[model samples]
Target: MSEQSKSPQAPDRTPRVVIAGAGMAGVQTAVALREQGWRGAITLLGDEPHQPYDRPPLSKAVLLGKADGATLDVDFPGLGIDLRLGCRATALRPADRLVETDQGPVRYDYAVLATGAAPVRLPGTEGLSGVHLLRTLDDAERLRPELAGRRRIVVVGAGWIGAEFATAAREAGCEVTVVEAADRPLAGALPPEVARYMAGWYGDAGAELRTGVAVASVAPGAVTLADGTVLPADTVVVGIGARPATAWLAGSGVALSPVDGSVLADERLHTSVPGVYAVGDCASFPSARYGTRLLVHHWDNALQGPRAVAENIARGEAEGVVYDPVPYFWSEQFGRFVQYAGYHGDADELVWRGDPAGAAWSVLWLRRADGPDAVAGAGRLVALLAVGRPRDLAQGRRLIERGALLDRERAADATVPLKAAVR
Candidate 1:
């Protein structure tokens, strides 16, 4: 037997494993542990009083009253995990491997830093009564009433939340305006051409798109721009960005990425410190596909990372499965169902598979001019961006990976279905 197999298994003794931040990431960790046949006692620490819930529907269905907060309740009882809700994790001491919470200090045999992230609020816009951010159930609940009447809503960022909130505001019969510092929407993720197509979406949906504008300050019923233009608004929803909630790990001997405040984890999701693993939005791991340390904050990543960590923690290693996903995210905004799978960083060419002027459309991003036949990374198809046709995304993803040469003329022709062009 290998030395690892011969080593005596760690005494179970109902090993107490403590997880902080009871969002999707935290709850998924506990559930994944049980699924991995881990017999350790699991305790979840969260700042919210409610049980673990899904967060994506908050700005969309929840705000529309079609969905309620309770609908997001995760079945933790079914997984045999003790949930310590309504409490915040204050600190972590690696020297003693303990987590300090508002209730008391919980000694941990293994610690999972799934603290997730905090919504970045635009500075100089604080203390405003009507300003809101969607990070927790409380934030969503507090802003729920503001969407009732015909209110003037100003979304401070043109990213996912801003676009989604703008959509919701327009649905609520409110006038909406989106402010983005970049030239177009989703600039950080999507290419310029793709973003321009999305920019037209806000206008078509009756929401103003104030691109290349920066917020100077915010006051009651108005957002002042850098150019001194005051946009009137009854509610200001800030979705500028988010920073990883790693303040508690400041001196905890864990390596954290200084760029976005994300934790640095190896292929096993193990941190530099032994027995300390980080996952979800708090972790930046090297991706074999992207060839970079990717920090994906989507729901799928959190749901997948814990299983890898649990198996590794229990048996010292987990092969065949790691936390590298293709990176997919979907947003429902302005009556447009937007979905993008795969990353398209610095793509040189973009081909529209459908009509951008129409409600349902999709775009294929390529790194070079040749074709989707081009290999990914150096010069290949990297992302499938679809606004309405969700099925096209799946087909496009498959063709792009196999380096299939697409008929440039008919491939992007809206009249032809993507699958039909495959052969």
Candidate 2:
């Protein structure tokens, strides 16, 4: 049998590709496939009844009521893909190359798992209508009315969602109390100094920031602290974090990471099984910056990863480019726009470009020292974190790996471009 003859010939029909989860990654995958001239029948399965929409805005604009939830509509029919909304995908059988959903079994030549993550609900708080989690448009819609009553809103966990919710609650005239077991906000992502600066933001925003305190329990009227101190709350918003929605993949031969239950993928986002790929919040791949497998649950990664996967899926091993874009994320909290680009886990030194106490400042993390204040090469400015400075983030992203020690006097000028700090 020759190379082409040894294999059973594929049917002379458009390849059927079923994508589970209609989030950003899945929708974009469908769009990219069609745009790449993939004539295959694409079926997008979403557990939610609504169309795909940008999720980042949910915690900020949607919660603040500055944007309506209904305005979120991703044109699916315009892309000529079958949209199966409000349906759940039950299982995947790689041997059969078919996905079992509530509607029926969907056989496919290729399948994508962009299932995304599920909000972690605090145990014992279920059935309490006041308790909420912000992961979906519907979740934001349900919690908006509670914001208008000036209620005491207890935000559990001080991660990005918690901080954003605290900001929105304060804007809604509600008393916001943030409880975090960590010593500072964003302790997992930012340094202690930077985290402390953010801790002060809650107080400055007129919201209570309680650090190093574990949430013992949530009652109807209050949140009980670890020390038995009760914080009155009419609404408790849980932002503890998210776990991958890979429950359906159990016993399906797809390897998932034990660390966080994320699907393990190579640079091309291919799972252990061939012909199937994973991306977005559900998958983790080795990152050159961190030198280990990392799970980046950000908007840009979800939006951009599909193109790489689509090319690989369409052309197989002939596709050369591996998915290795710089990781970036942003947040709006306490009337400030915080943006971070690159990863700083291994940075040797952290330098502030501006006064932290001032209205605007950005910090650049340099991995290597090229003499006194010069660091160059890739991964040098492994990460740049900025507060209230979007343009600085844009400039710093380009300056990263440039090996230039920032001059505070020059940086304070406010006239220097972020990339020109050293140049």
Candidate 3:
């Protein structure tokens, strides 16, 4: 008999998808898959015992006691998702298509890695009481009482998390001091000239902003600067940064980014492993539009990346779905609503909108191009940072997606609507 004639017909069965994390990305992936009409089995695994929750609130509402909890508004049982809370995925066995968890190895037809990121802890601060890292509900909860007591807080790193934490600490009547190793606040995220204006917000909020200061060591009640400056603190919050939580994928044959250990996912969110996909903070996807691989660790990325992942999984490669997105994120700090959209690189031209020292202002970043029309090319809006200017951010985001060429003077005019600036 011919090989084709001898082949047995395979029985049709529902696909099983195992998601390794139960944070926003993991939960959203499961929800999106179901909403996309995938009647497959979904096993959502999380290391935390608490129910899946939104993380953004952990820094704002939850920390300020404005909200009780950030638990996600999802009925896991009703959705028929296998919500495995408090279960840790120890390793990935790609050869057998199984996720080795503390509970047991769970088999899957396809697996989605949404492990997310872990907060970078301050060195030599381990086992020290009153030191915390805010990345989860438990971390926020632990810090809540400290804030309620109106303790003196020394926040390390003047990044988003640190600024937000300081805002909350000040609101809670705590003495706040933000220490950054860089020369200005948001040094890693914004230009010094832009970040210089933001530094004033800390002082306006009654928090001391100390930049270009390195922490030599962190103790229970104080942080010692490299210059031997001892900053008194009843509580210390480390907000330096976070790294992708992909240590479990070691030896699993999954290709991880050498830069940040993020899973190297394609434009479609598929990992090096044939049957596996990665999304959110734990995954870095290449953006053909930006000509770079972006590892966006924000709520928007988590919310948006899932749609592409789910579609590709459901419709397959023929769908040609890509996960390239205009990166957007917002932060509430010093009584200001700060929003940013799109990717910006060194080559992007920075255009100022309105007075930076004023209560409301925005910054437009245009992509640089060469040629006779270089001036017009440089006016192509690619990214925007709006401080207390939501309309600018809202309009700028749309214009960026449209690849709108803007007039520099009109784009920088606070009186003009960003959409109208496009020529």
Candidate 4:
């Protein structure tokens, strides 16, 4: 072993890897290391008492009691992994190779940070009886009763989580009122032209949507708007946004992004500290594919980032793979399947495959061939948003990965397959 990562123990002691946050990223990293032939001590830590479970279903099936919980189907005992539930990593000491936790301090040769993210609660809503945030399984369990009672719900944000919660609430026969500070839903995600069409969805689903307004205060039984308008809300759901849960990294000397508090990982998913890597919602990685650093908080990132981290850790540093991926994520809301892929740029051209008002349509973001940045993947497919069109998403995602150039005229034809439009 190199003098850098060598521990204080004798040379023959087995190597140990400590993983914090037992979400998909942490669990997959532990399993991937084993799969990649790392037969050493692996310790997985989680703050929650329940076994490692999925988060997406907490807003859908679990809220409606259609399923108990989205528990992952990994056999930790069979794999010889030490999985510790309800043990949260308080701080990381890279210099000593020790992770300080509530249970105790644990030493390791390598560590992975996958602490994920925490939801952004509305200001002044804390400890309010009816205020709620739907990020964890417990939060969903707390909300199931309210939905079962058919309570009037006012969702704070119009982002992805808010839309999904509204969908679930509408399905459960509860009155849902979504209020957005922006003028339209998904304002931060999509441009005004694209997101305008989604405004109709809330009304069509029998939910009330109030846009271009801010919430002034939250009471036990009502919400006061900034415009002196008061909304009667039996149960308030906050879905504004979420930030990376990296507060424990403070004073750890790990380089974190000033913009979002995400661990600034390099191309190999390695953090500023030696022998330490960050993945999933807690880290932001430099993306050569998009010429930017991206902090992706979607399930696909959690699923994909760990594999690269595992391969790099299992293999030597010289053989480490670069962690650039065409990002993808999907959501079912308002009875429409919404899928998005790749990272869109400000200068990219937008092309419509079908009418946005129609049930099935797609919007593709492409770079121009004659643009000044032609050398760096200009004229290539950069990003796409597919609504009620799975085939378009499947094909567009592959095209984005390949950096395929497309014929604009052919791409505009909704009937033509995306692959056929490739130049």
Candidate 5:
């Protein structure tokens, strides 16, 4: 082949960043790229046909039909983002820098894995009628009518989603019964002393909360317990848990955590593979602040991670910024405003600000002490949870970030400001 006869070189195309999911993390990544001064071609792919929306509302307002939808207020065209709906990425070919989607192969200069998570389903209930999950817009829409009909709902799992869904169902006049296999609500999340305080919220809302009771089987119109006790259920809402949607990256040269299947990103949100990054529920990063690997599945993590990923992408690898945030999240359930900040371990010294049975109370987790700043044998604030006390949460979150040591006696005084309690 003569040099002159050789195929003409392909035209130089604009550099592109392909985002795999259109959830909060993916959408924000595309937006943040522009904000971070990345003037490149951005292509975002979403499996759902509807506009990308918030997930938290799916369990609350959307489930009760109080709102039509919770679509994000981002303008894709205005932002120069090519948003492709109903196009799911099936595989990632790192060698070719191509993402194989259900639609077609999409080329990318860089790729972001923000596919979020998939809710864990009950065994043998894939196609069973009256069984549903509240993870997506369509899922919420399908469940709205069910809740509006005032059906007897049996929610499996007394986790955050279960409690929130029960709140919505009860608000809609449904007979809500939440069954948990553990000994208490949020056994997987909070310590028993704290979680025990929440168990009363369900019964107060007229919903039967059955803890330490395993579901032997789940069928339409009923849920059978391990003890052979059958609870009448018109509908079954499964909120057991969710696993990161990182299975598509298998063999794509991305390291995934065996514990949770999340992409094992470094401190800078960059994955094992060059020119590729991961964020949101699909990714777990080492938290030097917490001294452990953190897998955050909440909206806040999904909201905060993209900014770091975007900034790192805009700046070259050498100048990338580190991502180590003080993780925060809030929950509105059981007619109370609940907030939590920082990470706490069972070994932490537990301090009560007020009576747990009271309508408004807060609990602070202090590090076990012998430090110079130790007060009452506790050192530094590790974590804090407040029920109907936004002030404590707001002030304590900052203290946790600053690693402040709280004067135990002052912090235990419900009237004292958390900042004042800092030693």
Candidate 6:
């Protein structure tokens, strides 16, 4: 195996950093440690036998066969990092600072949990041949053949994954039908008005969008609706939502949210247990910028959170950095590029730029203020949603980070640039 020597100034005995889960977050933590000059024995363990790869493309590019797998670009042995593939972590022993894996127990000076989230599977759909959940490379490979053939595809849930899957299926000339429990598409993520507008995108793409429809059951060659309607489907795709992958840490003394079972990590991404931290979908970190704890299950979080974890482990607590990032994610569905940045809440004032019914539009979520004078000084740009507008998202992210105040009228004007809306 290739090896890199430790720094000359460093002590002879180096600390060992163990990372659980070999996904984007886990692998990034290992690389960040080395990049930050942490000359430790980094052990990266993954349950999957395949090489570490990106998950976002699994629904779009990989599913459509436009490209192959998007694997992580890192030389494992060359970096002096031990990458143990196909090793599932069974339990966490915080007191012993060891992780119990299928292979054996692995010890570490610092442990980072980045197990990531699993796709929500439909009940009674297990063992079904045509039923699928697209989360991993293997899952995509299994569903790709179904898309290649002419088949009736029924996608459950109108979330990002479902929409993208439907888009791909339609592009492949398959008969597509999307079923959503809510009255509008993306009901959990977007407002009803915005979701209503997005619902039309399905028809535009030649896919039938059925909202307010719940799946009664899934069987061979069909999906039964709650209203006693049977939709003929050769293949069924479920993309409801995902929860944090923290079941292994049940008795590990790490604090987890009772509502969603997410690891309650601090601003520094540290778990309740000492020398143990969590990031990515498995952990929820408090954000002072948004005035709440955010459980971000996107690519950006997995990419950025690891840097903070490495800083705390390498530089010590006094020099540790805080991770309060403006949550960002993008989705390509129904021939539209949808982008969102920053955290939005009910208290934020909704400012619409351009027309939501039009081809291109954006929404600015300004933090609510008390009085009229507050508009000039207190109504900060908290969040932004842009459809087919990349520049708005690009500029709004920076403005949101600086807590920039905005003039309401200027922000509402579609002609004005987002940066110029600042008071």
Every candidate's lDDT: 0.79, 0.82, 0.90, 0.92, 0.91, 0.90
Highest lDDT: give the candidate number.
4
In the range 1-423, model 1's lDDT, one tens digit per residue, is 211234448533468778898888888788778877788788888888786788898888888788777444557777778888887888888787778887767778889999998888788666779899987778888777888867888888898888888888888888888999999998888877678878988898898899998999999888999999999988889998888999988888889888888999987888888788888888889887667888988887887788778877766664425666677778887777888877666644677876787789888765554564443333345678888887887877776656454555566787787666643
Q: What's the true lDDT of residue 394 in model 3?
A: 91
Encode model 3's per-residue lDDT on 263-330: one tens digit a residue. Answer: 99998999999979999999999998788999999999999998888888877768748877889999
Candidate achieving the largest TM-score: 5
lDDT at position 414, candidate 6: 86
Once fitted onto the true fold, the runs of candidate 2 whose alpha carbons sit more than 4 angstroms away are 1-13, 70-73, 369-379, 401-415, 421-423
Cα lDDT of model 4 overall? 0.92
Residue 389 of candidate 4: its Cα lDDT?
92
Cα RMSD, model 2: 4.9
Question: What does the lDDT read for residue 102 in candidate 3?
Answer: 86
Scanning candidate 2 in windows of ten residues, the lowest lDDT window is 1-10
Q: Can you write out model 2's per-residue Cα lDDT over 190-233, one digit (the tens) per residue?
A: 88988888889999999988999899988888889998999988
Tally clashing residue pairs in candidate 5: 0
Q: What would the TM-scores of all predictions be? A: 0.89, 0.91, 0.96, 0.96, 0.96, 0.95
Off by over 4 Å in 5: 1-12, 369-378
Clashes of 1: 0
Clash counts per candidate, in order, are 0, 2, 0, 0, 0, 0
In terms of TM-score, which candidate is stronger, 1 or 4? 4
Query: Candidate 6: misplaced stretches above 4 Å?
Result: 1-13, 371-373, 376-378
Query: Could you give candidate 4's per-residue lDDT for residues 1-423 as a string of tens digits?
Result: 232346546543578889999998999999999998988899998999999999999988999999989999999999989899999999999888988888777788899999999999898888989899999999999999999999999999999999999999999999999999999999888988899888999999999999999999999899999999999999999999999999999999899999999999999999999999999999999999999999999999999999999999989679979999999999999999999999997788889999999899999998876646554333689999999999999999999999999888888899999999997
User: Model 1, residue 320: displacement in angstroms?
Assistant: 6.5
